[model samples]
Target: MRRIIYDVAVSRDGFIAGSNGDVSIFPHTGDHVDAYNERLATYDTVIMGRHTYEFAYQYGLPAGAKAYPHMRHLIFSEGVQLPADAEVEAVRADFTTHISALKKEQGGDIYLCGGGMFAGLLATSKLIDVLRLKVAPVLCGVGTPLFANVSERIDLKCISSTLHESGVEYCEFNLQ
Candidate 1:
C-alpha cells in the first residue's frame, strides 16, 4: 500500500498559518526552497486541501507551468474547481474509496500538502503513514495549528532531521 505523508511547514509555536490565514511569515530563504523542491520530486502525487491549493496557486507555485509535470495533483474540496490547464483533479467526496483507488493506480507514496483541517481528517481516519514537518524559526503565538482534535496518541518514529542555516528545521517521522 502506498503511504500517505503530510508534508507541511509550521512555525516554532506549531502554527501553520497566522490569524487571518496569513502564512507569509514563512521563510523562503537559504536552501529551504531548493530542499523542498527536491523533497517534492520524490512523490508522484501531491494531495492538498482547498485552502492549501489556493495558497499554492497564489504563492508557492506558478500557474500553468505544470511545476511537477511528472506528478499528479489531487485536491480535496467540495466546491473548488480545478484550473483547465492544471494537471490537477478534485478528489470525490468519498475520500477513502477514492484515495484507495488513487493509491492502487499511482503506485507510489502520496504527499499530503495540507491545511490543518485536511490533515486532521486524515489523522482521524488513521490514513497517514508519515508526517514530515519543516519548522520555521518564528512563532505565531495564536494561529492555525498543525493538527486539531487528534485525541488518539499516534506514535511516530523519527526517520531523519535536518537544520538549515536559514533557521528552518526539517523532520521526517514514520507513524508507528
Candidate 2:
C-alpha cells in the first residue's frame, strides 16, 4: 500500500504561508529547494484541498489545469467544475473512503499537498503516514498555520533531519 506524505514548507513559528498566502518569506533557491524538487519527482499523484488548488490562480494557473504536470492532480472540492478535457479532476467523493481506496492502488506514495484544514483532517483521521517539512528560518507573525482544526495531539517519530547552509532545516517524521 502506498503512504500519504504531507510534504511542504513551513515557517519556524509553524505557518505554511503568510496572511495573504504569501510564501515570499521562505527561501526560494539553494539546496533546500533543490531537495524539495527532487522529492516531488518521486510522487506520481498529488492531492489537495480546494483552497490550495485555487491558491495557484495568482500565478496564472488556469482553474482546471494541473499544477504539477508530471503528477496526477486530485483536487477535493464539492463545487469546482472543470472542463471535460482538463488534465486534473475535481474530487467530490467521501474523503476518508476515497482516500483509503487511493492508498490501496498500485503507485508511488501520494503527496498530500496543503491548506492547513485539509492536512488537519487527514492527520486526525490517522491517514497521513509521513511528514516531510522544510523549516525555513523566518517567522511569519500570522498566517495559515501548519495544521488547522486538528482535534488532538499527533505524535511523530523523527526519521531524519538536516540543517542546510541556507538556514532551512529539512525534517522527516513518521506519524505515530
- Please, what are the lDDT tens digits per residue for candidate 2 over residues 120-150? 8889889999999999999899999889998
The reply for model 2, stretches above 4 Å from the true place, is none
Tell me the lDDT of model 2 at 130: 97
User: How many residue pairs clash in model 2?
Assistant: 0
Candidate 1 local Cα displacement, residue 64, angstroms: 8.7
Query: Considering only N, C-alpha and C atoms within 3 Å, which residue pairs clash in candidate 2?
Result: none
Q: For candidate 1, write residues 23-105 as lDDT tens digits.
A: 78899777877898888888988887777777766656754334467778887889776557766787759876777677677
Per-model TM against the reference: 0.86, 0.97
- What TM-score does candidate 2 get on C-alpha atoms? 0.97
What CA RMSD would candidate 2 show?
A: 0.9
Query: What's model 1's lDDT at 12?
Result: 91
